[model samples]
Target: MYIDGKWKAGNSDFAVTNPATGEVIGRVPDANEHDIEAAVAAADIAFADWKKTTAYQRSELLYRAWELMVRQKSQLAELMTREQGKPLKASLNEVQYGADFLLWFAEEAKRMYGQIIPSARENQRFLVHKSPVGVVGAITPWNYPISMITRKLAPALAAGCTVILKPAESTPLCARAMMEIFDEAGFPPGVINLLTVQNPSRVGEVFCTDPRVRKLTFTGSTQVGKELNGLAATNMKRVSMELGGHAPAIVFPDADPVHAAKGLSLVKFLNTGQACISPNRIFVHEDHAEPFIQELTSRASRLKAGNGLENGIGIGPLINELAVGKVDGQVKDAISRGAKVHTGGQRLTEKGLSGGYFYAPTVLSGVTEPMRIYREETFGPIAPVITYRSEKDVIAMANDTEYGLAAYIYSNDIGTAMRAFEALDFGIIGINDINPTSAAAPFGGLKNSGLGREGAQEGIEEYLETKLGGFAI
Candidate 1:
């Protein structure tokens, strides 16, 4: 654990394992309530000076950290794959993606501008100043441990706010590695602190109830986000949440079924379908269902699954046994409800994969509203297909869920694409594109999906508070 510019030990320790091989790879501090309090207190004390520093001063430190990340990219990527179970290639890509945030936010720190407003009264002038929101408590999830931390941390630090971070227990090594870089970058004592706890509830409580923490940022499920949002409301602290997503991928009638399927297939199983934006319910036009299903199934069937350390592996093991059970249960429920499996539908316990929690990539057709996968967010490698007759029908089916994080539309027609983009209720929509998020663009959700944005200009605003100053001229 890192606190007040020093390494500290917890009351006890917890072992971190490799999800691929189920081997104990590393151990970290299992922080207690006292540790959580100390982290919060340290951040609170640091904010007094951190918030007063100029944006340029902050930018230089962030730039130094970003440079160090790039210099040690291979080491970071290897650590992520060993602990997080992502393929080495995917981990490498994640390292670059995560590092981009620090670089992007470092420049953004210099652009925190305020404005002068024209007053209705001739004798008065109005000025709006943007200042840091003081201490922030951030809780990040395990799915994308590297990127998730940088996504939240870079913006908070760039906005001149001190932070107390709690990384998910499953992947604390990546977080600790990141802290090492920040420390080497020469951040002041208490400017940033990290707690590697076995459970997050105790730390989350401290973040929500503590009066010193003025903002709370989290990336996790909607159920937990609601709980934290409610807790944060007690102190009226600013909050930012990037919660669960059940994204829909719609293939319009005008699009070629094979091309559309290829596009969706490329991203549907990304990160073994653990991504929040992975397409959950695929809506294909009835006229092109056969070809789309055939192509998608073939692609999903060919994907190689094994330990991520191997060179040519397509996917890796699920986080643990519970994740495998969730995927299997959803598949079985769909199959029982008359859905036909075109490819895999069982756990993989064959040679070389018997030790890990591995599930075969599956594609199920004839999935209806009655199936669990259609409604619930399946954080695994399973794709459920639902046929639609018209644009109106597809839109209705896409928006039927309580989540509105992301949606995708594949259409060659300009009018069709534009109409669907405008009609979708999701915050992030990709028209004929699977990967829609970037460091330069705003990313967030609508409705129950989440609140506030993560990247781009909107991301930094989450850690800032605006003050209006009136002057008599």
Candidate 2:
């Protein structure tokens, strides 16, 4: 890990295992309280001088980092695929997306405009300035290791806030690689610290409790997000959390089943369904459920599951055995509860896939709200589809969950698409689109999904604190 601008070993180390082959790829530091404090303290010291630098200087450094990321994109993606278990192509795309954040924030850095408020006194000139929130502790998840860190870190650093990034233990190499880019880009020591720790909750507690750390940003589960929110509340630390999601894809009667199915298959099974925003529930009109199911199942079956490094493989191994068990259990419970398994409901134990944890892409029908698969976040490649008669009924079922991260609609009718998307309670909405939104728009969730947004013009504001002042002439 790089701490205070120096490469150093930790008190203890933990093994990093590759999910594809179940082999120990490398080891990262098992950071203790001391390590977490030291990193935060370094960030605090760096923030003093770092925040004073002009936005142009910050943008230059960030742009250089983005360039380096592009240069090393392939290598970074390969390493990420080997570690995080996403397919090589997906990993590469993620790296590219990750680089785009740095580029976007690089340009957005200089555009942090403040407000001029009219004062009650005629002689007073009221002005508001946006300043960095000082030291930030960023906790990113393992799913999209590179991009998630970049999305948060880019904005924070570009906004002149020093950061201590605690990347997921399962995928620390990508974070290390990013630190390399930042160092090569000539960022000052302690301006950014990468700390890899096995005890993430402990490190997170330190981040929440410490007064020196002014802000905390995390991307993970809703349950964990709630706990961390409570912890951050102790110190009144500014927080930006992107939590778990149970996204629903609503297919209205007017849409083309085949097109919707193909697009849904692309996003639904991406990263083997290990994404927070991955479409979880499939709600199709009763009239089109048969064709939609056939199209969706056909597309899913075409997605080959194997080691991420292998070409032509769409779905890879689950992160670990636990992930495999979760998917399997959900499928099993749903099946036992009268749900029909359309295709690919079991695990694959072939010679080549014997070692890794690989569950086949599954499609389930006759799903009801009482089934386990319908209730939980089945973070795997299983699609439990439920049929609905009316738009009003499906919209009610979609908004029934506590999660509201993202919702999808596939409809040719503009009125149906707009009205349905608006009625569904989610932060981001996608109409006839598989991969929803872009780096140019704000991404986050409503309700239990999360707080604060990332990306677009709104992203930089999360790291800045507005200061309002006026002086009478």
lDDT of each: 0.93, 0.91
For all candidates, what are the clash counts? 0, 0
Residues 1-473, model 1: lDDT tens digits:
99998999987999999988889999999998888888888998999999999999999999999999999899999999889888899999999999999999999999999999999999999999999998999999888999999999999999999998899999999999999999999999999999999988999988888899989999999999999999999879899999999999999989999998898887888889999999999999888999999999999999999888888889888898999999999999999999999999999989788888889999999999999999999999998999989888889999999999999999999999998999999999999899899988899999899999999999999999999999999
For model 1, the local distance difference test gives 0.93
* Model 2: per-residue Cα lDDT over 178-268, one tens digit each: 9999999999999999999987898889889989999999999889889999989978999999998999999999999888888888898
The RMSD (Cα, Å) of candidate 1 is 0.8
Look at candidate 1 and tell me the lDDT of residue 334. 94
Q: How many clashes (backbone atoms < 3 Å, residues ≥3 apart in a chain or on different chains) does model 2 have?
A: 0
Q: What is the TM-score of each predicted model, taking all chains together?
A: 0.99, 0.99
lDDT of 2: 0.91
